[model samples]
Target: MSPDGMFLVTFSIKNTSKVVGREVAQVYISDLQSLLPRPVKELKGFVKVVLQGGETKSVKIDLNHEALSFYNDGQMSWVAEKGKFEILLAASSEDIRLKNKTESSSTITWTRL
Candidate 1:
């Protein structure tokens, strides 16, 4: 993350076998607030990649304050809560491959442009 709070996440995958493999990478973000982790946001697309044996590849995902927005019932709007957030890279929601943390503003209002 930069001083301005923008950040990028890269997913690295390596195929160590003798044949090609196909898979989709999924990403989820959580607030890390309670005992049971709940996803606040899920990246909107499927990251389908094909890799030949012995090849390594990476996929980059960009995030801004807007990407962290959550539905605020009291305000009847979307909000990005400040503090620590966890980014999870997974094959499925139950299958996490990587985890990382970052911070954001106390409260970020979503603006359309």
Candidate 2:
């Protein structure tokens, strides 16, 4: 991922059953440490994919500046502090499948990644 928070999240899914199935791949961002109160994980982007039995497909989610930010009461705008962040891939909020880390070299402000 880039410091601008422009990242392409790609993952592959396979349907092993005999019937078609649909899955929503959700992307969430987590602030490991924050000065303000925030959710453990925030929904950023998602993709809905349907696959036939035994079929496999790839899903992609585009993450940008907005995805990496949090509402700041001090600045009255969105902000992403410079540090480590976590990216979570899940079927739902309670069902996280994968996790990865990213970092921002500088504090990312509103309208910027």
Candidate 3:
């Protein structure tokens, strides 16, 4: 992430099989301490890739503050609190392949945008 709260997540995916296959890489975000009720993980980004036999490719998913924010009912706005967050890469929600940490050092709130 840059100093301005933007992320450029890069990872590689490979097709280990001997035949061509299709796959989708999913990105999920988790807020470690949300004041409001929220799911443990939320799907934020994804990319579909078709690889030839024994092929490998690199994928990137960009995440901004808005992607990590949750809606605050009382405030009637989206809020991204300052704290820890988890960035996950998965083939599906049931199959998380990688886990890592990121943080927001400053709080931000906005409505409809």
Measured by lDDT, the strongest candidate is 3
Tell me the lDDT of model 3 at 86: 94
Model 3 segments more than 4 A misplaced? none
lDDT of 3: 0.89
**Candidate 2 worst ten-residue window by lDDT:** 104-113
Tens digit of lDDT per residue, candidate 2, span 1-113?
A: 67566778888989999999999889999988777888999998888899999999988887776677788877877887877789999999999999998877778777432
Per-candidate TM-scores read 0.79, 0.90, 0.94
lDDT per model, in order? 0.72, 0.84, 0.89
Give candidate 1's error at residue 75 in angstroms: 0.8
All predictions: root-mean-square deviation over Cα?
3.3, 2.1, 1.1
lDDT-sorted candidate list, best first: 3, 2, 1
The TM-score, computed over Cα atoms with residue i paired to residue i, of candidate 2 is: 0.90
2-92: candidate 1 lDDT, tens digit per residue: 6565778887998889899887887677775522334565663348889998889988877776666666656676676777878888888
